[model samples]
Target: MNSKDLKILNLFKFDENLLISYSINLLKIIIILILIKIIISIGSSVIQRFFNKQKQSKFGFNEKKADTLSELLKSILRYVMYFIGIMWILEVLGLSIKTVIAVTSVAGVAVGLGAQNFIKDVISGFFILFEDQFAVGDYVEIDGLSGFVETVGLRVTKLRDFSGDLHIIPNGSIVRVTNKSRGNMRALVDITISYEEDIDKAINIIKDVNEKMKKEFKEIIEGPNVLGVTNFSDYGATIRVVAKTEAMKQWGVEMELRKRIKHALDENHIALPIPKRIIMNYKKGETNGN
Candidate 1:
């Protein structure tokens, strides 16, 4: 072959080798991804099984607590596996993990300064997990945002309020947390009755309803004491009933109590608040209408 043809042939071989190398790296990437998926699945299953065994064993973990911890562990496991798998794939593609880490370490100094909030979030996440301040599925109020805890990640905590708005809060910003699903919660129901009705009769009727509700709802933990005539509002006399219930059951108990009380008041002929109008049209010192 001539010199020009020889050069063309050598270039073709070089391109061929490069294509083969890239193809092999692509295959390795696919394999690494599959392995990561398998590992994550197995890890999650193991974590779930461990927590389930704890529930069945003498471990102090209740079912909800077990489930909560299991999910958090699975989250951590997935993140770790994905990170390792990514580094492995990068190495397969001829990017040395050590070199990448070394460069990242140098760049990290600058990145870390700007990412102080990120570091804080991760540190706060560890404290949150260790201290057992709250868990997944707990209804908590964090930083004025109240909702059921959805996902507690190392960087963020998610909350979906009743209006269906998702709030993604950085863990570092969480200063105070009001976990409503921890201990017994208070169920308070305020009912308004007419001023003309006999206050004592209404009070007795409400007390009887409360006693019946205590039997009906096993969620009730303590007395639903009736605080008679708690307020005299524009609506009427507001009677308050307060009870202690199983955590997260307070709202349900309050709703049921309100509904039953409403029906009971109706059955007992207790007059509820009614709007009265006295229209006086004085023409030459005479009242015309009521």
Candidate 2:
């Protein structure tokens, strides 16, 4: 072999004691990693079991809320387990636990100064969970975006909007949340009839249709009563119909209500306001002057 190659080999010549030490450290790290994976698996199962139990218990949270909390806790547990494992691994590499902590603490402070937004997000996430502002299945409007809550994380909240787009929003930016899934919603429809049509007759026809609608739509919680003439448009008087419905079913109830009312009016010969075209009969095309 060349002289340079011999020198490189001599520098790395095996020391039995040093080799054994490093091998032990490497084995210890592997064991630590394996234990971490096992513990995380067990931790996740426990969290799921606990939440599932809560779902059955009347005293605990409902299914949606329980699921949300369960997922969130699992995420936190994973982070904690990984942190502890990393610290242990560092100690196994001949670094003093105390020295490592001291170093991380200093480094953490430096990172913290530049990561104020991250801190705010975590704090806000905690409040979101504790205050019960909204849950994973809730339909909510936040930051002018409306959607169903998909997942809630420590740093971000995901929303799946009606258009199927997923929005990942930072928790800290959520100052106001409008939850639409909490209580009953309103289904409102404004129907305009021709000025020639009797308002009282139209009102009665709508009320009759709504009576049958109550039986068909289980979503309706309260009256789909006609509120009488609310306004006068260029074509007719606007009659408002309003009903209380189960949350998230308002639009369905509204569309159905309109359809039924329209048919009912049509059957009773109650004309609705619509554009009418005047056709002039002539041998050929006629001009406005003609």
Candidate 3:
């Protein structure tokens, strides 16, 4: 009787119903994983298309903002897909979701504390994007580092300077930003002449040249006004020339203005100041008198 009962107990323990449930759960998990992959693929494609279309529209849309939104959408989609996939997998394995969530909450708090800087960077980056501080391809000075913005990520900003130097900066550390590409830039030039030269004539020549230059270079927004007698220094009387030019055109305009002024002075016979010294010739036989 004891041997028969033991054999029956072993058969019951290896029941067919248990095998069927296990196989069904395994199939369900596999199907869920496949479904998750399909959803992720389709969702990513849709997001990419929508954003790409937005970028191409003639709505005066900002390229950087479109790129940022696209990236954020992709990141969120990936995370959500994986999270649901994992939960479904756990459910198939007969695990309690409530316990998993409790543990994840504890771990999340710890992670939040450990990743405070990352969180701050993300928050600051959002603010920067929303505030329109700067964008890709814009020349800006941030935290004393000046460069063209290469990329604007959630945590860091990438910049490429004129010298080909690349700078990676945390968003939270960027306290102040100076965007040089936003508005008109000022062009300044200073000219000097000898004290012996006629000041009135020099100013007149300068004003004449500026008038002609304004007509020549349409980039000059306002008069390259010759502010006469700006300073009377030891070297000479400093005359100032100032003009406003379009952004990124200031440098070229300034250089051209300087060249024009130099050429004008030469043509007008304006004298440049020189350091002077006096020397006395001594007789060959003369000696020092004591």
Which segments of candidate 1 are over 4 A away from where they belong? 277-290
Error of 3 at 141 (Å): 1.9
lDDT of 2 by residue, 68-164 (tens): 8987888788888999999999989878988998998889888985588888988999999999999889999997999999888877899999899
> What overall lDDT goes with each candidate model?
0.87, 0.90, 0.83
TM-score leaderboard ranking: 1, 2, 3
**Candidate 2: how large is its RMSD?**
4.4
Ranking by lDDT: 2, 1, 3
* lDDT per residue (tens digit) for residues 1-290 in model 1: 89999999999999999999989989989999999999999888998889989889885587667866787787789879988997898788777878989988999888886579878988998888789888878899998999988877777788889999999998899999998898899999999999889989999999999999988889999978897778998768999999999999999999999999999999999989986666676666666443
Q: Give per-residue lDDT, candidate 1, residue 143.
A: 80
lDDT of 3 by residue, 1-290 (tens): 69999999888888877898899998999999899999989998998788788889988356766766665566568778998999989878887899789878889888986578888987998888788888777789998999988777777888899899999999988998999978888889888888988989988988988899899988888888886788887768888989888777888988888888788888989977765644544766555432
Model 2 TM-score (2 dp) = 0.78
Model 2 ranges with Cα > 4 A deviation: 1-9, 12-38, 92-94, 234-236, 275-290
lDDT of 3 at 202: 87
Clashing pairs for model 2 are none
Top TM-score: which candidate number? 1
